[model samples]
Target: DQQVKQNSPSLSVQEGRISILNCDYTNSMFDYFLWYKKYPAEGPTFLISISSIKDKNEDGRFTVFLNKSAKHLSLHIVPSQPGDSAVYFCAASDSSGNTGKLIFGQGTTLQVKP
Candidate 1:
């Protein structure tokens, strides 16, 4: 069973517009959620994250929102730029004593058109 899922496979946004990505999880043990942006042939780089204690977290033009009750989360990017085009993966981890292994979704490819 997939604990984490990204329903949308891809998203396209015009430059200076807004880009939104959605993710869902079924595991209640996930206490930490993270979003990562990846370029071709490169490892994913952390974008933003939110703890289960917080409903929202923002970093610069990127923001992550979590709904613990719904077991869902989303990432929003404002004023999307060309450089923002990349594959985004939603990851979850639990810090409840065991190993902190990250479970990542397939990924959502975001294209920011100039």
Candidate 2:
């Protein structure tokens, strides 16, 4: 069962613009959500994260929002830069299990044009 899903396979945004990436989950057990950014031939790096207790979290130009009721989440990049272009993945973990295992989305390719 694919618990996490990114409906949009890709998103294109102009540089210095705001980019929004969306994700949805079928499992309500997920309590911790994380976003990862990856480039070609490189491992994914953590971007931003949010917990079930909180609706939003922000760091620098990246922000993540969670809607528990909707079982959805989004990543917002303000003033997106060319460097921000990458394959972004949405990950979620069930803290209740404490197994440290995470479920990931198919990933969305974000292209920031200059």
Q: Which candidate is the best by TM-score?
A: 2
TM-score, one value per model? 0.97, 0.98
Query: Total clashes, candidate 2?
Result: 0
Give the distance in Å from residue 17's predicted Cα in candidate 1 to where it truly belongs.
0.8
lDDT of 1 by residue, 12-101 (tens): 999999999999999999999999999999999989999999999999999999999999999999989999999999999988957889
**lDDT of model number 2:** 0.97
Residue 58 of model 2, lDDT score: 95
Candidate 2 residues 1-114, lDDT tens each?
Answer: 789999999999999999999999999899999999999999999999999999999999999999999999999999899999999999999999989999999999999999
Show how many residue pairs clash in every candidate, following the order shown. 0, 0
lDDT of 2 at 64: 97
Residue 38 in candidate 2, Cα distance off native in Å? 0.3
- After TM-score superposition, what is the CA distance of residue 27 in candidate 2 from its true location, in Å? 0.6
